[model samples]
Target: MPYIEECIQSILAQSFQNWRLLILDNRSTDSTDSLCSKYLADRRIEYITNATDIGMIPNFNQCLDLCDTKYYAILSHDDMYADARAVEDSLTLLENDPELCAVYSHLNWIDGNSQTIARKKFKTMGKVASDTIAKTSIRTCRNLFGVPLLVRAAAVKGHKYESAFYFTADIDFSIAIGQGLYHYVIDRPCYAIRFHASNTSMRDFSKTRSELNSIADKHRIKLSVVDSIRMRINDWQTRAGKHLFYLYLDHFRKFMPACQQR
Candidate 1:
């Protein structure tokens, strides 16, 4: 509920107050649904409570399916915009360029103290962008990290997130949309990503890699068979390093409890 509260506050504080909020509570074990209901009573907000926990892609698809707006965006319960100007700036870019199917901004990692920890993976961006933006994010926003995009609702309604991707749907969706869809990248300091050890990215690196590779291959974006093996190998090696790091803390016990034992 605290996380949802923070997210809603970010939405409410948007400098561009014209946008509406549609939240789908995917069978949260927490009280996120109740908090969303309270926000929905505001007439500007529309909220839906899911009957079961439908993983990320489907949940995102469901959210977009309900949108009647010209643009659509996904804001996870755990992340928020840095300030009111973020949306105002993004909307301005999108409005000016009808060709832009999406717009993303530079995001900074923020600690629990609300201090800048570091810039997120995708470092190159612009106020006016092109569809080619997706190719560059291949390295940084590749797998489980690329929700920083504000995409067109039509685009979202067109490509359904692969149900097979439990964690990397954003990556697959971004790739599938390809350079066919235009995107604008706002260079300003816009998104604030809260970094907590409890975040899903920290726990699901395994499934994350598989989903990423699956998407990349599906897009025919990867190189030859040997090169594809190398990419997957690199992804696995990184995850292995993280796994070994946790093992030293005697905390791997808890971390691997739910993760399937390899």
Candidate 2:
């Protein structure tokens, strides 16, 4: 609710003019309804308020179901596009490569007030094989294909997020969609991910870790013994990396004023 306006404004400011914006409100008690009502004047935007409060993953699946375009991207209400050409650039990549299932780019981490924290860049770019992506996802226990990714409609015809996993469903969905396809990676950061107190990932460390382990276990069954051993080593590395990240986040928070702790 806090950042929804920014999210919609970013979409409305896109260089790609032919895009449609769907605002699926999951029975929010906040000023979401009134706030979104202001945007209904734009013919490109459609606001749908759910009669009941469906959970997050189900709402995401509903978005997928409602999409009728040749290419689609899901933007979180709390996040915004960092670049106006985000959709245009991603669409160009998919247009050039028919075999690519989706095109994803790096993201900039932003604070609650939309202040840029850091730019997250990936070393690799261009066409990456889906099998390699699946393996990397399993090994790293992370969703390397972050949001604002434009996915081809035909590529993910009937694919849906796994409801069983809470925080890590995107990782699972990434693995599933990359089965026999390739994904295009753009070098620039196209999206801005917000870090705040209410974020699910920020709230629960143990649950997130548990979900990551479950996702890894589910995907690692087909791996060879050597790969499995490597995954275990990588898991430890990821854990250490996360621990260091939390330490850094804590240090960062200490310097911020108490009012801006979020």
Candidate 3:
């Protein structure tokens, strides 16, 4: 609840003030209802509590059904906008370019203490024009080009998250969206993701990896031997890098004095 308030507050403090906030409480056993009620005083913020736990995918779909905006974004409760201009900047880019399907920015990973521990810089293809980028992504399958995306409501007319994929639905949906529409990367970190012990990405790491392959097969996307090997290597390297980073931090904490470390 503490973490979630920060996420909601960040939205309230956005530079782009002309926006509505929808807080869907999926039968949370916590004080989510009371907390969200506090914000009901503001006409722009709408709070809805589900009588039963409808699961994550259903909640996401409900959000889409409720949205009437030109552009919409699904924000994780554990993530927060890094700057006031995060939404404004993405919206400006999408508004200026009529052909753009969506616009998204890179994000930083923060620890439980709200301290930045790592930054993931998304590789941009400048502005994708056609299916070339999507075809390339099938073989590589490296990036899950999802979230923090200000996606055009019209572009997602027939698109919805694949409910079969409990963990890798974002990857599957990203591939689906990148099929024919044009997408753009903002080339800047505009959001912070809370990386903690309880995060789904950490809990379902193995399942997530297997689902990545399943998604490719389900879509009949073929990958060459070299491309398959490269993708595995990239995934392994990422895990190793995060492990090594934590090890270095542990060593520093043990060996260096507090003042010296500072």
Candidate 4:
């Protein structure tokens, strides 16, 4: 319940007051209902308690079904916006570009104490021209990391979230939208994922890679044999680059004066 409240407070403090927050309590046994009740005074927030616990994927679909606004994003119970201007800035970018179907920002991973653990930035993320956006998306997948994105309601009006891939549905949905309309990238880290023992991804890490492969197969978004080999080579290069960077940093730290050391 504390985590839930933190998530809600982040939304309430957004610079963009025009948005609505739909809090769906999927039959939680905790104090979630009571915690949500305290925020009813803010008309922008709406809390709905489900009679029974629907699975996670269906709950995600329900969010899509209930959305009436021009844009909507799914904020997980353990995730929150990084700042007051995240939504405002994201929506502004989407509104400014009619061709963009959605906008996602870099995400910071935080622990249960709300201290940042790591920050991940996708190499291909940023303002991309329409001509090369699809290629970039196919390559990077926007490094989704289950972070929220402000997406055009109309761009995905008829499409439904694929329930088959539990851990990789966000990637599937993003690719679906990207295949049609271009999506812009906000370079700043605007959203945060609370990484803790209870996180589903942490619990089921084994399924992620396989599920992603299944998603690509289901969507027929496969890479050619040559492209696949090139991707593998790139993966190795990226790993080696990171290894060399860390080695250099470690050597530099060891050689630094004692006064400069942490």
- Quote each prediction's TM-score: 0.78, 0.88, 0.86, 0.81
User: Quick one: RMSD of model 2?
Assistant: 3.3
Model 2 steric clash pairs: none
Question: 42, model 1: CA deviation in Å?
Answer: 2.1
Cα-based lDDT at residue 138, candidate 2:
63
- If both were scored by lDDT, which would come out higher, candidate 2 or candidate 4? 2
| Model 1 CA lDDT for position 191 | 77
Better of 1 and 3 by TM-score: 3
* TM-score winner: 2
lDDT of 1 by residue, 43-141 (tens): 888777788887767887887678788776788777888768877777777788766667776677764445565675455555333334443334333
Residue range 137-256, candidate 3, lDDT tens digits: 444544546464578888777777877877767667766666667777767778888866566454444454466677778766777788778777766765576566655544543454
Per residue, candidate 4 scores C-alpha lDDT tens digits across 146-244 of 354688888885777777777557777776666656777678788887766566453343344455556567667666776556545554554465456
Model 2: per-residue lDDT, tens digit, 1-262? 9899999999888999998899999998889989888989989999998889998999999999999999998888999888899899889988988888888888899877788777988766888887786666665656677764688888876878878887778877877677788888788888898887677555344454456557666765356677667766776777677677666665675476775866
What lDDT does model 2 reach? 0.80
Identify the runs in model 1 with alpha carbons over 4 angstroms from their true place. Answer: 112-115, 127-145, 229-262
Assess candidate 3 and give its lDDT.
0.73
**How big is the positional error of residue 20 in model 4, measured in Å on the Cα after superposition?**
1.5
Winning model by lDDT: 2
